[model samples]
Target: MKFLIDAQLPVRLSYLLKSMGHDAIHTKELALKNATPDTEINAISIREQRIVITKDSDFWDSFYVNQEPYKLLLVTTGNISNKELESLFIKNLGQVVDLLEQHSLIEMSRDSVIVHQ
Candidate 1:
């Protein structure tokens, strides 16, 4: 799976995803870097068919209303350190991928993963 890590997420998450054999890129790597606008991010995801992994609710709203971004992983494990966020992601990523096969929107928290159509 291809993934685009949003600015709110650690850049290391992109490397982790790559290490797991997925093609992934962080916003910081792009020309806009961390300042990339949501519209641009949504455009890139559509162009590349990348799954957007973000903590931003804007993407969630857009996905539900516009059905853009191709796919989404909305991280809801609020107020955690980057290390903890990465760890939680690493622990649950496999399930996330599995669920994404059938669901376009996925809400991932520290305790559970919920799939939304």
Candidate 2:
């Protein structure tokens, strides 16, 4: 899967995703950097067929209401350190991918990964 990592996430998360053979880009890599607006991110996701991985609830609202992005992986483990956050993704990403293959939305917390279709 292709992923667009959000501003709040560590850029290393993108690197880890890539190492796992998925294409991934962090917001800091974009022209607008971390300041890239949500709408623009959504647009890029749609254009590139990228699954957005974010902690932003606004994307959740946008997906529920507009359904513009092709896919979503919501990270709900609040305020974790970068290392812990990366570890969470590393531990749960397989489940995440499985769920993503079968659903449009997946919400991942520290202890669980839930699918929302």
Candidate 3:
């Protein structure tokens, strides 16, 4: 799956996704870098058909209100170390991918993954 990692997430997450053999890009790679607005990000997500992976609830709100991004993977794990975050992805990514294939929105907490209607 293709992914557009939001500004709040580390660039390393993009690299991790790439390492897992998916097409992924961090917002830092954008022309506006981390300052890229949510609208532009949503546009990119729609145009590129990339699943937006973010911790930002604004995107969560937009997903329900506007549904412009096409797909979303919300990180609701709260505060955690980068390693812990990466580990969470590593452990649950397979299930996450399967869930995303059928659901427009999926939430990943520290211990479990939730599929949102």
Candidate 4:
């Protein structure tokens, strides 16, 4: 899967995803480095065909209400560190994909990965 990691997500997560053979790009790597407007991110995500991985709920709302072109992974872990985020993704990538394939939105929280179709 192709992924566009949100600014809040550690850039290392993108590297790890790429190492796992998935295409991933950090927000800083995008052209809109200094500007992370919601519409811009959504537009770029759609244009690039990349699933957005973010900690922000706005992206979920944007994709959900707008029925945007790509998928979204909304992380809801509380006060998480970079290592925790990466570990979570590493430990549950397969399950994540399964959820994503079955639903349009996947929310990875402290307790579970919630899926919404």
Candidate 5:
């Protein structure tokens, strides 16, 4: 699947996704800093058909309440180091994919990845 990593996530996570053969883009690559609004990201995700990967809960409003069909991968693991975050994605990307097929939201935490369909 395609993905656009939010500024809150390590930009390098995009590399992890790309390494796994998925199309991915980071905010930096888009020249979008922290100021990029959630709605804008949601729009871009819809336009590009890319899933939105973020740690921010505000995007939930855009994806769920606002009824944005763009896929969402929310990392709710408390503030963590970059390495830890990378490991989480690398280790569980398969399950992540499975969840995505069945749900719009995957709240990836340290212990488990919760799916919200």
Candidate 6:
């Protein structure tokens, strides 16, 4: 899967995804860097057919309200260290990928991954 990692997420997440054999890019790689607006991110996601991985609830709202981005992975694990976050991905990424293959919205917390209708 291809991914556009949001600014709120660590760039390391992109590397992890890439290492796992997925194409991924962090917001830092964009011309606006971490400052890229959500709308532009949405456009990129749609144009490139990338799943948006973000902690921002704004994307969540937009996903439901506008269906702007093609797909979304919303991280709801609040205030965790980057290592813990990466570990969470390592543990659940397979299931997450399977779910995303069939669903447009997914929520990942510290303990579980939820597939949204």
For every candidate in turn, the CA RMSD to the true structure comes to: 0.8, 0.8, 0.6, 1.4, 1.3, 0.5
* Residue 33 lDDT (model 3): 100
lDDT per residue (tens digit) for residues 22-72 in model 2: 999999999999999999999999999999999999999999999967799
lDDT of 3 by residue, 1-117 (tens): 999999989999999999999999999999999999999999999999999999999999999999868799999988888999899999999999999899999999988899986
Model 4 C-alpha lDDT versus the unseen true structure: 0.83
Give the TM-scores of the predictions, in the order they appear. 0.96, 0.96, 0.98, 0.91, 0.93, 0.98
Q: Which structure is stronger by lDDT: 3 or 4?
A: 3
Give the alpha carbon lDDT tens digit for every residue of 1-117 in model 6. Answer: 999999999999999999999999999999999999999999999999999999999999999999978899999999999999999999999999999989999999999899885
Clashing pairs in 6: none
Taking the tens digit of each residue's C-alpha lDDT, what string does model 4 give over 48-86? Answer: 878888888888777768976388988899788888877
Model 4 alpha-carbon drift over 4 Å, by segment: none
Question: For candidate 6, what is the lDDT?
Answer: 0.96
Error of 6 at 58 (Å): 0.2
Off by over 4 Å in 1: none
- TM-score winner between candidates 4 and 5: 5
Model 2 weakest lDDT span, ten residues long: 68-77
Query: Which pairs of residues collide in candidate 2?
Result: none
What lDDT is obtained when candidate 1 is compared to the true structure? 0.93
